[model samples]
Target: MIAASVGSILRSFVDGVIVLNDRHEIIWHDLSEEISLAAKAGLPISELIPSAGRLDFSRYRAHSTVNGVPKYVNYSTFPIQRDGETIAVFSLSTNESKLKDWLHQTIEIKRQALEKEKNQRNERNGTTFSFPDIKGKSLAIKGLIKEAQAIALHNADVLIVGETGTGKELFAQSMHNHSPRAKSPFVAINCAAIPENLLESTLFGTVKGAFTGATDQIGLFEYAKDGTLFLDEINSMPMTLQSKLMRVLQERLVRRVGSNEVTPVECTVISASNEDPEKLIEEGKMRLDLFYRIAHTSIYIPPLRERKEDIRFFTDYFLAYYSKKFSKYVPPFSEELLEVFLAYPWPGNTRELEHLIENVVIRASETDEAIEVDHLPAYMRRKIFADPGYRAIEQKQKETKKRPLTSIFSASHVHYIQQTLEETGWNISKTAKKLGITRQSLQYHIKKHGLGKRD
Candidate 1:
């Protein structure tokens, strides 16, 4: 009589309750009838739950649809303690669709606020106009900036190629800032960062109810309308999405993820790749047709080692900027420190240097008026004093050459070679033509003195 009364009380609740063994196998389900109906043709009592592995069981909350209607479910699993030890599992799932809807709305509001903050930063910093604070006084950088400025006037697509941290995005932003689309949005998206399965929907937005959990929101393409879209690491874009992107470029229109309607966008597309897009194409990681579409104008940014003169300029800029920010009265570089800056081969380029200076200024500001060798990071000090590769190379050059190590000829010659290469994409034929020399002569010189190999 007591068992019958407990069963009658349990059947009155509209929640699903299940008991499981240690292996997560369901031993009994209180709402078996509802579960079976929700499962459609499948047996819900026997079949394992989808995405159950992702659930913590201790505190799991999510939503699923039953018969095309959304159902919010909050599940909690407690270890069944018995005989001073856990013997089984007790699970409780409640319908909380109304609460779930309210929470989702709240989250969306917060997300929008964060997005606005990001956009505001972009505006204040002129992210589309400024270079990546790359420090350099090298002739290569000067000439490259000039060319980028010239190309920015045209509506042609631009492709920036460089190794990672070589500031490809910086060049792209600089190009857009100098271009006709300067005042418009410069939305940047990393092709590799987004999941391959969702890359298409992210690039071209989806309509409400397009798929499960999809809301009416604009995608990257729409967000960048009438402006510039900087696609970073374009080589990592999936091949399937590549076809769709190629079409959008050629047609100037994008179809939303689940809609037939086509939306036209007037925007400039600038793409950057750490790897050679041509090589990616050959390796089946990128599309050749898409490459040609985006490579109407291509710019290559030189690495830090190849533009040694810029190091001092960068260090000075960083020092002053960081000193002001940290409220430090840091003195100008001592002769020894300046030499250290010029000689060290910065593997991480401008970004790394900026971070190092910021650290120094912070430390020095806390206790001293000026930054000294001790305030600098350990890596900077080590590279300055102990790096044998650069020291050995400098020594060898000094021994083999008759001119002073800092001779005007050496500097000017390095500048000339870099300028020629930048103008020609390191192509021997074009560089030779610009320099008024034969291809064989250019090759002879490049081999004679290691000029074009860095590219």
Candidate 2:
């Protein structure tokens, strides 16, 4: 019975088999002809597989050049023992079915299951993602999250400031979910998005006589009773309304439109603005007193361009997320593509990154190959290659065989951009249009290349 079992196992090793001595030399092998038809007993296994001698692990995977193309091979070993002592070892190879390939085949099923379960759980959690759901590891983000968590514990109002698409609302939701009033309604309204006529009533409620077709109803504040009211784009609110809001904060009371009854405020108000509060005040877009009342504890979220590592971090996350979402066998991005991604100013910020991944994954095929350069946008590729600055770095890299330079532009690109900015009087929209890039992308390069305001 033992002899039959051993014979079956040896027959199963039809792909390739080799018995090696303690010296890493082959005592015998029925190896593939492609390896070496001239190979024989007593030859060093390293002669056939150059990496054989370096196999420190019982099983290891490495790439080897085959037909001018690199291919991965897996080598596994089993000890051949005699009288409870190991004498020789049998190494086997299944080059046709690489471990990586096998893992990829099964990942589709596993990923889909995990993604479905996660979505179900998220739906259960009421659509508000907690801090852990926010993916970031940069010190800028780490410090911000720590500070936000501390602020969440209090009942005082918060003011969150960041550029558009920097996830101002995400931070607000995270704060609300972690706060003492997590169970209460986390109401949100965009001041800029709503019409001016309805905006006041939307916040402080309205009576039947307030205006035509108006009914006695609660506004966001009363509806959010003992909960949280997120006021987004606060700077866009009219200056007159800002005074009323400030008064409510100071008195902790709100009165309905066309009614004398004052309702005691029970909800905490968290406001958000895309512009700098001080700058807005200087421009007369926001009231100084309102800024003080609403911004008791404020949080500033750094943009994606400033946090480059976070871009890479989010890239990996979005890749996995979109892959599972689409049920595609999407491979990791090529290094060249990642370099382009890191270099991008991401004018749209994290939202842009998310949309970019979604765009690619939906179009990607089920294959084991990595996402190549052609997979990216044509406009992005053209701009990078056409840029004199990028070409300079490319030339530098070829000469030194080093990684791409962090500075995407050479001195010349900087000078040109600076000249254009100076010509436009530093108007971002005009400069971006002149340069044929988005305003956000131009801003990113301006910050990165130190093209600050001219003296």
* Candidate 2 global CA lDDT score: 0.77
Backbone N/Cα/C clashes per model: 2, 1
Evaluate all candidate structures by whole-model CA lDDT and list the values in order: 0.73, 0.77
Q: Please name the candidate that would achieve the greatest TM-score relative to the true structure.
A: 2
**lDDT tens digits, residue span 10-111, model 2:** 658645677777666677765644334324333445645544423333343433454565444455666766787667777666564354667887898799
Put down candidate 1 lDDT per residue, 365-422, tens digits, no spaces: 5334334567788877777658765476457557647655555336676678777887
RMSD of each: 23.4, 16.9
Please give me the total number of clashing residue pairs in predicted model 1: 2
